[model samples]
Target: MASLKGLGYSGGMDIAQLKAFPLFAELPDAALSHIARGATPLAFPRGALICRKGEFIQGFYCVLEGVVKLAFLSPEGHEKIVDLVHGGSSFGEALMFLDRPCPLYAQALTRCQLIHVRKEAILPALDRYSSLARQMLAGLSRRLHQLVLDLESYCMQPAAQRIIGYLLREAETHEGQTREVTFPVSKALIASRLNVTPETLSRTLSCLSEQGLLKVEGKRILIHDVERLRDLGPR
Candidate 1:
């Protein structure tokens, strides 16, 4: 598939594209224009390392297309995915604002196009536009809340419960008695994200299948009954 920048973001991302992001959505055109001018547009192939841990982030970035994962890597090469950031989402804002080294590294899961908006440009804009500061705070708050929830789930939930909870969360849009959940990345990558071994994930899926709760076909799972699956775990 063709990448996003290849579709229309040629040369560099324009103010209109910058304005489409939630952080910039409320800013005036002039402020958006300034920020866009300073932002760097870049593309990456799958498996590209966008940034490394311990490196200082000079700016925040937003993915225009494709998927990326922010993860921590061990010296022995094991990985733990902290977040699966998809198109239209942003990262690095808090790290940049805090002037600290990144705790996690970002890598592309597919061909990706992103814009890096510099602190130099954003600081002035934030000073000029009070709403921008509020939006930044709101975004960071959401991330922190999610992290807390994740910690709770990791500490309290069992492996099957975590995997089932993930399915229900992903199947939120599907209506009626039946629902479907699709894995955005490979099951191995997902296993890492959920803090489970691939073998355990396969075993759990088989267990669920044997119970007639769902049918797994490749990366897509057809949920037989949403309520049954939901009732299997937490209330």
Candidate 2:
């Protein structure tokens, strides 16, 4: 773990950067500026540990650039990737509100720039701005719903189906009949998230390629037949 010795407050982050995030998009400039002023920008190189499991939640974190992986370590020392937080998204808000320790570890999947908004700054703002509180609740609800869906996928879906579902979900973000997707994280991490072995994930990708549904080129995957790929997963 790298020390935060050289980490200094970033002057570049302002109201505009806060507005880029959906949670703060509707906030007035004054409010956004308040939040921005409270933000501490921190950069993490790939594989850097942002927070470890059982650590106290100090503030809410937003990914300004790059990706972060939330994972948990089992008693046997195996790690399970729970979720991936992308740019423009905020995390740790719920835990901060509850004043609880983080249940999982957060690690930088790539070189990342993040803004940490201290709890003291957010709680007062939440009271001063009802819209901010509502937005936070809505975001927490959506995260809960996603967790439910993940539970269903893990319990009811097969490994290959889960992989197919993951691919199809990625494809939906693009606007086309065919889509190109790239894994920002390692395949082993993805396999852990999908609850499958790395070899199983590789085999599933090979099968999809053999069926002419997709083409895998290193970390990039080209989905040749979107409909066929969707058919392999749960509707």
Candidate 3:
């Protein structure tokens, strides 16, 4: 269960906070202010269940700080990480249009703040602002494209390829052949995200360590060979 009494920013979102997100950035001040009036500012502690399957989402949520993951949980306790929403991004846009129960559970991976924009607030905005509608549709299209790519990875890629690809995504900066990637959440969550078991994840990391590819240090991994890792990704 999630507690609504999150620390700080208990009131409705201000127009500035609304504009901070690209989805609403192009909207006029008056439109944004109107939408902000209905928006709810919320915070959640790490490990809190933000929303669950079968819940009727009145609107989408935008991450203002920290990370939230959309996932599926089986009755037998198995878990699959569908996507991770970081700061400055929004989720559940499709839900508003679908008019159906949410299919996945959402949980906070870290202490996070979000703006829950009601469907009522956005529908009128979308009707009035073509830019806002386009942005929202673009966001949804990107998510769908990524989902297709994920399906391809899950179906066609080998386990090592998938793991290496996962590690390489966070390799935004590197010194020579070395780069560092930090796990923002637990290894269990990571394994689920990669569609692998904890034992498999451990074994793969150890193998890479033995091969002088990377060094694992509790939540951080130093990649010693970026090119080699990339070569292994999706190949």
The candidate that wins on lDDT is 3
Top-TM-score structure, candidate number: 3
Tell me the spans in candidate 1 whose CA falls farther than 4 Å from its real position.
Answer: 1-12, 74-76, 157-235
Better of 1 and 2 by TM-score: 2
Worst 10 residues of 2 by lDDT: 1-10
lDDT of 3 by residue, 97-116 (tens): 98999999899999999898
Q: How close is candidate 2 to the true structure, as a TM-score?
A: 0.64
In the range 1-235, model 1's lDDT, one tens digit per residue, is 2222322356755888887778788898888888988788888878788888887879888998889899896688867677888887899988766889999988889998888788898889888897889888898898898787556434534887888888888888656433888899999999999899898888878777866778999999988877667755544
lDDT of 2 by residue, 2-47 (tens): 4232155546567787889887877888887777777888888888
The TM-score ranking, best first, is 3, 2, 1
For all predicted structures, in order, the TM-scores are 0.63, 0.64, 0.66
Q: Which ten-residue region of model 3 has the weakest summed lDDT?
A: 1-10
- After superposing candidate 2 on the true structure, give the runs of residues whose Cα lies further than 4 Å from its correct spot: 1-6, 9-12, 156-235
